[model samples]
Structures are given as C-alpha cells and as structure tokens.
Target chain A: MDDPLMLARVQFALTAGTHFLFVALTLGLATLVALTQTRATLSGSAVAERMTRFWGQLYVINYAVGIVTGLVMEFQFGLNWSGMSRVVGEVIGAPLAMETVVAFFVESTFLGLWIFGWDRLNRWVHLGLIWVVAATAYFSAYFILVANGFLQRPVGFTMVDGQARLTDLGALLTNPTALLAFGHVVFGGLLTAGFFMAAVSGYHLFRRTAEADLFRRSMRTGLVAVVVSVMPVAAFGGMQYAYIQPTKHPGAQESAAQVAQFEARFGPGDYTPPGLATAGEVLMEVAWSLMFFLAFAMLVKLPFGRWLERGRVFHVLMMAALPLPYVAMISGWVFREVGRQPWMVYGVLKTEDALSDVGAGAVAVSFTVFTVLFAALVVVNVWLLARFARRGPEAVRLGAPGAPEPERPALTPTF
Target chain B: MQTLALVVLAVLTAGYLVLAGADIGMGMLLPVLGRDGRERRLVIAAFAPFFLANEVWLVAVAGVVAGAFPGLEHALLSGLFPVFVALVAGWVVRDAGLWLRGRVDAAAWRAVCDGAIVAGSWALALSWGAVLGTVLVGGSRVEDGVNAGTVLGLPLALVFAAHGAGFARWRLASGLAERARRVPGRYWVSGAALAALPVAAGARLPWSQVVSSPEALAVTAVMCVLMVPLLAAAQALVWWTFRGRAESPGYL
Candidate 1:
C-alpha cells in the first residue's frame, strides 16, 4: 500500500474497473438493439424499429459517458503508469495505436452518421453505420484484450537488458487466453443489456402505457438474447478463464511448500502452518462457481419466463443476478492480472521494474474523487434513463382513445 | 527473427499511416476543403464525430512499439520527446476545437480553433515522418536487437513534411488535390533514402521471415508498388464520395 506502484495499480484498477461496467452494458445492449431493429424493419414491423430506437437511444447516451471515461483512461498511462509505457511501449503501443486508427475511427465515424444521419439518409444505410459502430466497439475491446492477454502469459518474447522485446507477434495475436477473455467479456455485455431491456419492457407492461405487442416483443427479444448469450460463458467461460489464471489454483501448493520449509526449521509440534493463500483461492473459486450456478438457473427459467409475466419473475431475478457477473468479471480481471503477479509484462520486466515513484496519498485522493464522480454518473445515467423510459415510445406518439391528447396537431417532425 | 519482426512493425506502422494519417489529414484540411463558413462547419461535422476514436490508432501503434520493441520505444520516445508532447497536446487542443463548437459564436474563436487543430495535425503528421526518417536513415550499434536510425535536422524535417502532405492528399482528396500533387516524388525519394539507410544488423518486418523470406519479398515489393496507384485512386474516390455541395445526415 505504501509503494507508489502499488497505489497506482489500485488507483487505476478502481477507476478503470468502475467505469468498465457501463462500457460492457453499452456494448451488449447496442448490439441487441441493432439486431431487434433490423428484424423489425425486415418484417415491416414499426414496433420492432421503435423498440430498437428506444433501447438504442438509452444505450447511446450511456455509451457517450463511457467514451469519456475511456478517454480519461488514456491519460492515466501518461500520468500514473508512465513507467510501464516506457518499458513495453513498443509492443503494446501498436494495438492501442491501431485501436485508435482502425477501430475507434470506424466506430465514431459511423456512429455519428448513425445518430445524426437518422432519417436524413437512407434508413438501411443508417442501420449499416450502426453495424459499423458496434463492430468497431468490439474491435477496440479486442485490441485491449490481446494486450492484457500478453501481460497474463507473455509468449513469443525475450528479455534484453531488463526490458521485454516482442520477438513473436504471432504468439501475441493467437494467445488462447485473449480469445477466451474477449468472448467472456462480450457475452457479459450482452447479458447486462438483456436484463436492462427486459426490465424496461416489463415496466411498460405493468403500466399499460404502450402497445402490448411492442412491449411483449421487446421482452421476448431481451429474454432470448440473455438466455443464449449468457449460457456459454456461465457453463464454459468460467472453466476456460480458471485455466488461464493458474495462480488461482497453485496458491495452495505454494503455501504448503512454505509451511513444509518452516516445519523443517522447527519441530512439527512447535509450529503451525498458516494456510491463508489456499483460503483465498478457494474463496475465489466458490464465488465464481456460485455465479455460474445462478446464471444457469435464470437461463433455465427462460422457456417458462413468459409464463411468469404476471409476477415479472424473470426481470426481477435477472437484475438480481447482474452483480454476480460483475463480481466474477472483477475477480477474473484481478485473478488474471494479479495472478500473474510480480511481472508487469511476463518474464520481460517485473512489475517492480516499471513502477513510478508516486506517493499513496495521491492515489487514494484521486481514487476517492473519481469514485464519487463515477457514482454520480451512475445515478444520473440511471435516473435519466428511467425518466425517459417511463415515457414509452407510444406515450410520446399517439395516446389512448380515452386518455388526454396533445394540444398541438400530431405531426412527425421533418428532419 | 529480429529482422522479421521489424518488418511486421514496418507494416503495422504503414497501416497506422494509412488509417490515422487519413484521419489527421481530414481534420487539418477542413479549412482547405470548405469554401465558406457553412461548408467548413459541415466539414468539421463530418470528421468531428469520429476524432477521438480515430485517434485510437495512435494509441495502438504506441502500445505495439512500446511492447514489442522496448529498446526502440525507449530511444525513440526520448529522441522524439518534443514531438510526442506536441502530438498529445495537439490531440487535446483539436478536441477542444470540436467540443467548443456550441459555445462560441465569435468568428475569431472559430478561426482560432480551426487554426490550432490544423496546425496540430500538421505537427503530428510531421512527427511520424521524422520517426520514419530516423528508422530509415540511422541504426543503433547494438549486438542482438532491432536498431533505430538517426533523425537528422534537415532531411528528417523535410521528409516529415512530405509524409504530412501525402497523408493530407489522401485524406482531403475531394477538394485539396492539386495543392499536394507534387508529394509522390518526395515520398518516393524519402522511401528510397529510408530503404538505403545502413544497419549494423538486418531487421525483419512482421510477415517477411515466414512467407516473404525471399520468394515472399515479391508480395511486399508489389504491395509497395500498388501503394502509389492506390494512393492516386484514393483521391478519385474522395471526390466521388464527397463532390456534392454537401449531404447533411441527421445524427452523428
């Protein structure tokens, strides 16, 4: 905790991690919106398009905030972890660079066109731009994931003069951990979006505010998205990730060996073994297992989720399950990064080498400030979205026959 | 293997040039592309929505360079410290220009914003050129690693300008073509000089060791050849895509 490097690590971890939840939600929800909207258009159902636009609008707002949070992340490299950049800047820098060029550019460009171009350009063409935007988001995520994967299990590299050289670009590109991590991350986003979408649709159902068909359709789509996307990761992703972070399993062995050495120094009866390390790993494993089981249980109820519409069991239960995935995600990231402890860029430069000489007070201070700001953002985003959501698409459009009507004539605003 | 990996880096760098270069060029050439205030606004609008994400390429390129070739990353960051600082500062200022669009009605403010961003873009583009010049012309006298080239005062600056101009031509191909048509020769000269620079030990690009060992050189050679025509074609494509008075889409 006293180490500048340690403080920097925790500071960035707290900030990056808190913001990560928002990003994943946007990534998954936006895609789901795109898919639903596309289906609506193809099927000549304006209901679907409205559903798409509705969820998409909320997602884009969340995305805008996420993007700002992400930009702040870049600055942290220059400010907090300049040492890491100095050492492995050549190798990891390329992907970060390319993500800016290829992925970020493509996403932002098309997203603009998608947002501002709506109705001004061809409808299908606008949709295409969103597809580009969504793809680019995932692409950006991929580059970062690959870089992290290298940190976990550095392959195709060599050390020279206390620094790491990326001797093997192929190995970095094809690391198995990178792929699994990417899948796990993307699917988790989809699941978050699913729950949010389902909840919104359910809210509409309870209020009797919008057309029942549209709300029902949204519910169905969100349920299917959640059930299908979450199942693979819950059932398989955990196992795959567990393997990659071998640190999660071998702590027991390490502690046992340490105890044995201690016993050799003294009589067995004279000394007791402290099994703290094993306890930690076992706790992590149990948490992960419990999360998996919970996800599985929710998914199992999907076929019959429609039946529980009166009770709204599925939406309530899934939202309850959100924290599980988040916990696992944070655990997975910690297990992966910390699991490969002692090395910032495996085997090339130890974490000890790349730490800056910053004080812990600075880290703790910044962490507290950002935590407040992020908490505020979360509250505002949720509140804004909820307020907007309460006014269904139909409420803004046509009112019920007996309900109060607008003062002005009903005319769609021309672009 | 170092030689092979260096080649991969070169390719990645070239990719960076193609993508990010285009983006920066677009940002800088907005003034030149638009004939009037309204047109300029449209131009800014066109590129504005994408600037931050567009800059992500710089991040990725830096990540790879930092991670893959730590030695080069170190020496280069130190050598190009001024350029790196300027590049980042430029990025920040350019963002200021776009984000400030709603707050300012003063023609002076708009003019200043545009000028700062365009100047920043030019500086960023040239910085990369200097980097390429250094990579091409100089080498480290090391035993078993990739060697970086020296960055001379004059030739490096000129070559950097040439890289900036070439990228601008490609990015603003629609309206600003003739202003930069003379850059290909300068580019070819820079490329040749860069190619001829001496190295104590040979370096490899990413794909060269496996497929492009000797027989594979042809593909890269041909790829370089295609670059010229592709560059020329890009200009035509730019005009074809944006030749109209302006198309105002609603959302981004």
Candidate 2:
C-alpha cells in the first residue's frame, strides 16, 4: 500500500473507474436525447417533447461534471506516467491530440449550441445540433480507443532514435483491436443509457407521477434502446475476448516461444500478461450473462404491457437492475486493463518502466486528494440529478413547446 | 512551409491563452468584482455559452505538441508535472463550482462553490503562467526526479490577471468594467518586471539552441514579438464593438 507504483496504479484505477461511470451514462444518454428530440421534431408530439427536455436535463448535468474527469485523466499521464509519454508520445499523442481538435471541439461546441439553442433556433436546426453532439461523442471515443488499441496491439509505428513514431496513420485507424473495443464501448454506452432511462421511467410509472404520458413514452424508448443495444454489446465483447484469448492465455509452447523471441529482442523478462486467468474476467462474464437475462425478461414482457404495467414488483426489479450494466462495464474494463498487467504498451514497454520517478508521498497525497474529490463529485452529481428527475419535465426551464412565446427571440439565425 | 505545423501550434497556444485567460480571469476576480450571488451568476452567465468550447484550443495545443513535437511535450509536460497536476485539480474544482452554483439553492452551497471558483481560478492562472515562465527562462531542471524551475511563478499569474482584466474591460460593463480596466495598469508594470527576471537569468541560452530548427525558431520569435501588440489591438477592437452595457441580463 505504501509503494509508489502500487499507489500510482490505485490512483489511476480509482480516478479512471469513477470517470468511466459518468462517461458510460453520458455516451449512452446523449444518443437517446438526440433520438428523442428527433422523434419530437418529426411527430410534433407533446409527450415526446417532454421526454426530450426531461432526459436532456439529466444529460447536461452528467456532461458538465463528466467533462472535467477527462482533463484529469490527461494530467495523470504527465504526472504519474511521464516515462510512457517520453517514449511513446509521438505514436499515442497524435490520436489523443487529434481527438481534442476534431472530436472534443465538435462535441463541446455543438453541445453548447444545442443547449442554448432550445428556444432560439428552428426546430430542425436544434435537432441537428444534438445529432452532431452524438456523432462527435462517438468520434471522440474512436480516437481514445485508437490510443488504447495501440496499447492492446501496437501497430503503425516504427522505433526512431529510441522513440516510437507514427509511420502509417491508415494502419493505426484500421487496427482490429481498436475497432472491436470501439464497438464494445459504444454499445455498452447505449445499454447504460437504456437501463438508466428505464429505471427512472419505471420509478415514475410505478408511483403514478404527474407526467404519466412522459414516463410511459420514455419507458418504451428506454426498453427499445436496451433490446437493440444488448445484442451488439454482447457480440462485440465476445469478439474482443476471442481476439485477446490466444495472446493473453497462450499455450505452454506458445508462452515459451514468445519469451524466447522477446528475450532476444527486448532483452529479458516475462512476456505473458500476468495472471492469465483472473476473477475480473469471470465476473465480467457473469455480469454480461445477468444483463442478457434481464434484457430478455424485459423483452419477453414487452408484449403484455397491461400485465407488466400493473406489476409493481417487476417495476421494482427493473429499478434494482439499473446498476447491472455499470457492473458489467467496470468488470469488463478491469479485466481488459488488468489482463494487460506489467505492460503499459503490451510487449513494447513495461508498466514499471513507464512510471515517473516522483516520491511515494507525493503520489499518495494526490491519490487521496483525487479519491476524495471524485467521491464528492459523484455524490453531488447524483443528488442534483435525483432532485431534477423527481421534479419532472416542468422543472426544465428551456421552455416547453406549447408555452406562450416571448415577444422577441434573442438568438440570431446563424444558417 | 516545413515549419507550418510548429507555427500552427504557437498560434493555437496563443489563442487558448488569450481567450481562456479572459474566462479564467473572471473567475479569479469573482470575489472582488461580484458583490453578491446575483452579480456572480450574472457574470458567469455572460461567458457560459462559449467558455467550454474555448478549451478546445488547449486540447489542440496539446495535440500539436504530442503529435508534431513529442520530444518537446515529453520535456515540457513531464518537467512541469506539479504545476500541471495543480492546474487539473483547479479545473475540476472550477468546473464543479460553476456547474453546481445554479443547480442548488442553498446559500451555503453557493458560497462554497464561489470560494472554489476563486481558488481554482488562482491555481489555474498561476500554474499556466509558471509553465510559460519556466519555458522562457530555460531554468527548468529535473531535481529529485521531479520538475523544478527557477521561473518566478507570480509574474505569469500577474500577467494572466492583466490579460483577464483586458478581457473584462471588453466584455463587462458598468462599475465592473471600470474596475477591470484599472487592473492591467496596476499589475502590468510589476508583471513585466518579474518576467524580465527570467530573460535576464536565461540570457545565455540561445533561442537557436533551444529550438532545433532555425526556421521554426524564426517563426516562433516573430509570433512572440507580434503577440502583445496583437492582443492589445484585439482587446481594443472588442471593447469598441461592445462599448455599452449588455442588453440582456444573462443566457435565456
């Protein structure tokens, strides 16, 4: 516990884990918000509009706090793992930098516009901004996975003067590992959102809240999102698992062969990902199975809306299942990251070698500070979201569509 | 043409520093400039729409360094880990404060968030300036496996305050704008003097040696020379364009 490397690992894991909770929800919910808004725009239904505004408030709340975690994550690289940046900055930095310029800019800028444009812009234009937000969110995830993919399976790089440099951008983008991880994450994001939407909607529905039409529509949308996302999520997770199994858990001869080959080139040290068979992987599988079962049960009850609607017990069960996706996602990430143990860049660089030389006390202080801050943020964020979620769509001050119009709209037309 | 990426990087960095500097400056001056909670909310509302997007330039700057000049990023970022960690922590608190202020109704909560905003702003401003000062002075050295530099951190922070005041002068109105206008004059002299310490100390470190490419160094030198004047002109233009008090109170 006193070891700097161990402390650094704990700090990274805690911060990243907490950050991911928000990200999974943000990525999932942003899409649903966009889609719900689109449905409102096309149908001009009041319930759909209410659903959009209600869910959108939750999305904005999560996004506001979630965005800062990413900045913290970036800081950790320089502070905790400066060695990795020094050695592989050229290769990994490109994708990261591109993500900021291309995806982060587009997502943040359009999200601002989308938020403020609610009362200002034309219906279609407002709708377009949200779609842009959704698209760019996925785009940002793509670049991040590209960076992570390089760690999983280094590609499109050449060792130049003791530093790894990008030799081919095309190869980097098309890396199979990156593609698989991207698919898994994107679908997982949707599942996270779907479950969240369902749980919130179920609570309101069970209690017979003021906005029954709103909750009912939201429940259906959430259920549809869950059913649609689960299949792809499972498939992608399986593909990624299949891809990693051989390398992660090599045959006896394969392990010896890899060690022999790596020893000649990289000098010495064990080549396999430590703890080939880990509990995290087993837990991930179990969580995935539970998610599949839950989703299937919900789907089976989809036809008998009348019967299920009356079943308060089923509604309560749905509420309880809300945390299942989060469990699956965390376990999956733990398995993937921990499975790559000892190596920060697979066979290229060892994790121990990539640690900065800062003292244990400094790292310990930072770890403690970050843990406290992240925990506080999570609590505050949840409280705020719950307050608003309970308050219903009317609390959203963006103004409902049917409300009396102001004498003059302040926003100027941009297009 | 060959040094175009480097030039782009410099321009992006300058843009982030100027634009984000103003936004952060407002946060730094929150306690003094804002008399009450209403005034603080009013102040934040003015820049709320665009401030988050303004951070893109920072990401772009990092991108350029990591993508185009990995060696420099490694040298600079890893060298200034303490300042960066402080900056990130400041950002987290600042963002939380800004985002949470309107969400809760409790006066105590609002007050705590306001305090966080001020503290976060100070940390960010000081750290950002220290990073730049460290670079210009060439006094950065690795000591005890940590980045330590001889750059007087306060000067850079003062410079940011001046920059932020200039922004406030343009974007703000009434007594606040007038107060903001007085800030640069009060601080710029001292900041300039403090900044000179770095130049004087690093007088022997040739710009050509610090930057490997002659063309890139020339471009950088030109940008550095043009920067202050350009910022001044832009600030003047903005002030002229937005001379009167804001028409609407805040974001609708």
Candidate 3:
C-alpha cells in the first residue's frame, strides 16, 4: 500500500479504466449518430434527425469527460512513468503523436462544426462533418492501440545507448497485437452502444411513453446493432486469447523460448505475470458468455419486434443487461493490461524501471485525487445519461431550430 | 526534422493559448460576465461551440512534445509534477463543469457546476502561469525556490482573465458585451497574450538538448505537415459557422 509503484499502478488502472468506459461508448455512439444523421439527410426524415440529435447529445456528454480523462492519461505517462518515456518513447511516440494530429485534432474540430453547423451550413456539409468525426474517432482509437500494442509486443525498434529507437515504421504500425486488439475494441464499442440504445429504448417502451414509434424504431436499430456486433466482439476476444496471449505470456504454449530469451537478456526476475491476470481473463470470459446468451435471446425477439417492445420482462432484462458490455469490456481491458504485468513495455522495459522519481506521498496524493475525481465524474456521467435517457428525445436541444433563450433577469448585474 | 517539430510545437502551443485561452478565461469570468444562472448559461454558450476545437490545440502541443521531444516531456512534466497535477485537475474539473452544467435543469446542479468552472478556470490559468514561471526562473529544472518568475504567475493569470473578458466583449450579445466591456482591453490584448505564452515558454527550454531521434522527428514532422493544414481548414470552418454573436444558449 505504501509503495509508490503499487499506488501508481492502481492510479493508472482506475483512471485509464474510467476513461475507457466513456471512450467505448463514444466510439460506438459516434458511429451510430453519424449513421442516423446520414439516414435523416438522405431520407429527410424528421424522426431520424431527432434520433441523431438525441443520441448525439449523449455522445457529446460522454465525450466531454473522455477528453479530459484522456488528458490525465497522457499526463500520467510523463508524471508517474517517465522512465518508459526516457527509454522506449521514441518507438511509440510516433503513433501517439500521429493520433493527436490525425484524430484528436480533426475529431474535435469536425465535431464542433457538426454541433454548431446545423441549419446554418448546407445540409450535405453538416452531414459530412459527422462522418468525419466518426472516421477520426476510429483513427484515434487505432493510433492509440498502435502505441499500446508496442508495449504489449515491442517490434521494429532497436536499443541504442539505453534507449529504443524506431527502425521500422511499417512493422510498428501493423503489429498484429494492435490490429487484433483494435478489432476487439471496436466491436466492444459497438456492442456497448447497442446495449445502451436498447436499454434506454426498452425503458421507454416499458412505460409506454408517448414516443412509442420512435422508441420502437430505435429499439429495432439497437437490437440489430447487438446482433451484428456481439459475435465479432466474442470472436475477436477469442482470437486475441488464442493468438496473442500465448506469444506474450509465459507458461503458455510456445512461450518458453521467449521467456528464456527474456531471462537471459534482462537478468533473472519474476518474468511471469501475477495470478490476477488469469482472474481478469476468467471474469471477462464469463461476462462475454452471459452477454452472448442474452444477445441470442434478443435475436429471437428481433423477428417479433411488436411483441418485443411491449414485453416488460425483456425491458427489465435489457436495463439489467446494460451493465454487461461495460463489465465485459473493462474485464477484458484488465486482462490485456494486467496480463502484461511486471513489464511496462514487455521484454523491453520492466514496470519498476519505468517509474518516475516521485515520492510515495506525492503518488498517493495524486492517486487519491484522480480516483476521487474519476469516481465523481463516473457518477455524474451516469446520472446525466440516465436522466436524459429517461427524458427521451423530447428534451433534445442539439441542433434544435431557434432554441429558446435562457430566462434573463429583470436587471442584469453590472460587471 | 527537428526544426519542423519545434515549429509545429510552437504553432500548437500558441494556437492553444490564443484559442483555448479565451474559453479558459471566459470560464474564469463566467460568474462576472453573467449574473444569474440564465446569464451564466449565456456566457457559457458564447464559447461552447468553439471550446472543444480550441482545447485540442493543447492536446496537439502535448502530442508534439511527447512524440518529437520525449526527453523534454519527461523532464518538464516530471520536474514540475505538482504543477502539472494541479493543471490537469483544473482542466478536468473545468471541462466536466462545462459539459454537465446544462444537462440537468436544476438550479443547484448548474450552480455547483458553475462554481467548478470558475474555480477550475482560475486554477488552470494560475498553474499554467506557474509552469511558465518555473521554467523561466528555474531554467531546465524546476526547483522549490521562489523567484521573480514564480511571483509573476498571479499577474499572468490576470492576463488570461482579461483575455477572456476581451473575448467575451467580442462574442457576447450586446447587453453582455457591454458588461464585459467594463473589464477593458479587447482582441488586441488577447492576441498579444496568446502570442506571448509560447515565445516565453520557448525561450526557457533547451530545445537542442531535448529532441528525439531523427527518424521519430521526421515521421512526426511529416504527420504535422499533413494534418496542420486540415486542422486549420476545419478550425476556420468552426469560426466561420459561429461567426455571429451568440444569441441563445447552446447545448452545453
């Protein structure tokens, strides 16, 4: 508990985990929102447009915290893990930098345009902005995974004067670990979005809200999203376990030689990850199995959309199932990150060696601050999402034509 | 490549200061610019559409630093760990406040979020000033010793506040703009403050000693070359789209 390394690790886990919670939804919903908007533009359906605004508002709210949490994640690397930067930063830095340039920069700008450009710009242009935002969002995820992939299975870099230098850009970008993980993450995002939409729409249907038609259509969309994405999510997770895990972790088939090579190069240490890695993997698998069964059940209802909408039991089940994808995604993330234990950059840099020269006290303070803040954010984010979800599309103000002004006081206060 | 990286870093930093600085400043004066909850919402709406785009400039700066000058990222961020922590905390709080303020239609919720915005904005402005001051006075290493540059943090924060006021005067409706006018200084001061931050910070760092390997730098620079123009174009679109004065409260 007193060790700075342990504290730093916990802090990273909590903060990064919280950030991923928002990001999973952001990536998925951004795509959904873009698709909905595209349909609205092409068909000129007011229902689709309202759907876009409704979902888009939630996306923005989630994204707001995601961006800030991401900033903290970036800062954590330099603040608590400077040693990794001092060593292998050159290799991973390129993809990370490209991410900011290509994704963060473009995504934010386009989203801003998309948000404020409604009714002001040409309809086609406004629609184009969302697609751009969605594309850039994926690009952002890809670049980040590339960097994380480097840590999982370092390649295309050579050690020189105690620092890893980039030798092959192509090899670094196409690291199979990154590509596979990318698929898993993207599918996981879609699954999360599917459940979120279904849960929200299900709640409305259970209560027989005035917008039954709207909720029904969204319910269908949500179910379709789940049916399409869940299989891929499971498949990708299986692929990673089958293909990537054995190569990275010791005690797995064909991993003895790599373990031996590591021991010889870095001198004797525990080398193997702790038991928690297996625990996380098991938890993830269990969650996935549960989601798979639930998804299948939902698939059965898809053909009978009318019965499904009125089924209070199904709505309750959906609301209950809302947390499944979140749980699975986090557990899967835990497995991936924790499974690579002892090494911050597997085989290249030990976790202990990558810590910054900060005191235990400072790390503790930061750990406490970040945890509390993130927890508060998560609470508030969920509360807001739930509140808005309950209110339904009637409350959506995003891109509303001539939004009413806030009530001004009789006398404005002087500056 | 090194020069290009440095140039990109400079441009991004300056862009953040000039663009995002206005919103941060506006956040600092959120209460003053708008009296009641309704007024405050308006003040926030004035900058809402542009804030996300503006903040990304800082993200870009951090990216450039980490990617092209890992040594600098390691040295600067860790050397001034406490300051960075405060800055990040402020950033998180401020953003959370802005994003969540209007989501719920409760007076208390908005009030609390507003308080977070003001406090977080001030914290961001002051901590950024501290970072700059620490570098200026302490050179490459940020020591605990108080110096002239350290003392300068407060005044720099005020500069940010004034920059926000100037921005408010320009973007707000006529009634709110008049209220903002009392603070004095308009776009010129804002521009000067924006241009000054990067130059001051740039002068303090030993750029030659902090650059990464040539290959990494070259790759990063090429990326910047490809993306910066697109960033510029998209940013111009945002500014153009919202060119008119903020008339109604935007989605927060």
Q: Name the candidate that leads on TM-score.
A: 3
The candidates, ranked best first by lDDT, are 3, 2, 1
Which is the leading candidate under DockQ?
3
- Tell me the TM-score for chain B of model 2: 0.71
Q: Give me the displacement of residue A159 in model 2, in angstroms.
A: 2.6
The iRMS of model 2 comes to: 8.5
Which 10 residues in a row give candidate 3 chain A its minimum summed lDDT? A406-415
lDDT of 1 by residue, A222-263 (tens): 777767776665554665645453333454565356445645
DockQ of 2: 0.28
| Per-residue C-alpha lDDT of model 1 across residues B88-133, encoded as one tens digit per residue | 4455445545544322345675677677667766666555555454
Instruction: Give the DockQ ranking, best first.
Output: 3, 2, 1
lDDT of each: 0.55, 0.71, 0.85
DockQ of each: 0.14, 0.28, 0.66
Angstrom error at residue B186, model 1: 25
Q: What TM-score, computed on C-alpha atoms, does each candidate reach?
A: 0.62, 0.85, 0.96
List A-chain TM-scores for all predictions.
0.80, 0.90, 0.94
Per-residue lDDT tens digits of candidate 3, residues B225-245? 888988888788888888888
Once model 2 is optimally superposed onto the true structure by TM-score, how far is the C-alpha of residue A157 displaced, in angstroms?
A: 2.0
Candidate 1 vs candidate 3: which has greater DockQ? 3
**Model 1 ranges with Cα > 4 A deviation:** A1-3, A241-251, A254-309, A313-315, A357-383, A394-415, B1-252
